[model samples]
Target: MRYWLLILPKLPANAMAIFPFILLKKASQQKDVVLINHEKIHLQQQLELLILPFYVLYLLNYFINLVIYKNHYKAYFNISFEREAYSFEGDLNYLTKRKLYHWAKFFVKSSGDRLG
Candidate 1:
């Protein structure tokens, strides 16, 4: 992952994946494996989508959810990619067992809660 640690971003998230890169809100969080694992999940998804399409789809989903929930935080939390990443971020070896396009399953179920 192409890491870029800085201050705050436009979004409310502490870290965000931009395909090959991960933009972190704080440089100190670099050693936080759980957070890195979370972003890594996003990297896998971005890779599967070949980058550009991933961002397009992500924005589409976020906008759709934003309309549905009428809440930015709720919309972001419900995004399929975020849902999938948040689900397995805690499992450091999740990348090994994860199936290709695993985020697809999230569209069928409500992936609970938000994680940093």
Candidate 2:
């Protein structure tokens, strides 16, 4: 499916440091490309998990990891979906007909089940 990205102007300072972020104002070509790819990865994940549940699972996993890890960066990095996205986002060709469940392998396992 085709997705369009919208850029917003002036994201919160905290968000700015990590994500290039989508702004309402015009964005530079490079920023637009990166943000689009990143958000597209999120969209693909959302679709795979049936939309609503993906977000619910995301929040729950994040909090659980935060409490267990006691480190925000580690918590975020440990997220299964984010792990996959970060691992492959730089490969501009990742989104083209990528296989489902390819990312699930990157999820960090806690015991038998994977985290996030």
Candidate 3:
């Protein structure tokens, strides 16, 4: 899949991966390899799920995590997708070695089951 980057100063997060696009909070973030890799991991996850279902599952996971954690930050961090991305974001070669449905392995039942 083709990927594109856009700089949006008002983005709530440092970066976000929306299928073919990776939205960044600032232009300098484009040089942050770890940040870009994190978003790329999300892109692969979105592509694997065919986009729409990715968002649906992502939101559903967040809400379920919210109910379990009662904190937005905790909920967001515990998401299967986020877990996978954050865990491997520092590995520049992770994408080349990643397998299909790899994010599924990060799915957790509770905060105790978090990847890292």
lDDT of 1 at 89: 93
Q: Could you give the candidate ranking by TM-score, starting with the highest?
A: 3, 1, 2
Candidate 3 displacement at residue 30 in angstroms: 0.6
Model 1: how far is 82 from its true place, Å?
Answer: 0.4
| lDDT (Cα, 0-100) at 27 in candidate 3 | 98
Query: How do the residues 1-116 of candidate 3 rate in per-residue lDDT, one tens digit apiece?
Result: 57999999999888999879999999999999999999999999999898999999999999988988888998899899998999999999999999999988878455677633
Worst 10 residues of 1 by lDDT: 107-116
Please list the Cα RMSD from the true structure of every candidate, rounded to 1 decimal place.
Answer: 3.7, 5.0, 1.6
Candidate 2: tens digits of C-alpha lDDT, residues 1-107: 55553445554421121122323344463365554565567678877777777778777877987987788887887777777777676777788867886656765
Which sequence of candidate numbers ranks them by lDDT, best first? 3, 1, 2
**What's the C-alpha lDDT at position 61 in model 2?**
77
TM-score of each: 0.83, 0.71, 0.93
| Candidate 2: regions farther than 4 A off | 13-26, 29-32, 108-116
Query: Which candidate wins on lDDT?
Result: 3
Candidate 3 ranges beyond 4 A from true positions: 108-111
Candidate 1: where is the Cα deviation over 4 Å? 1-12, 110-116
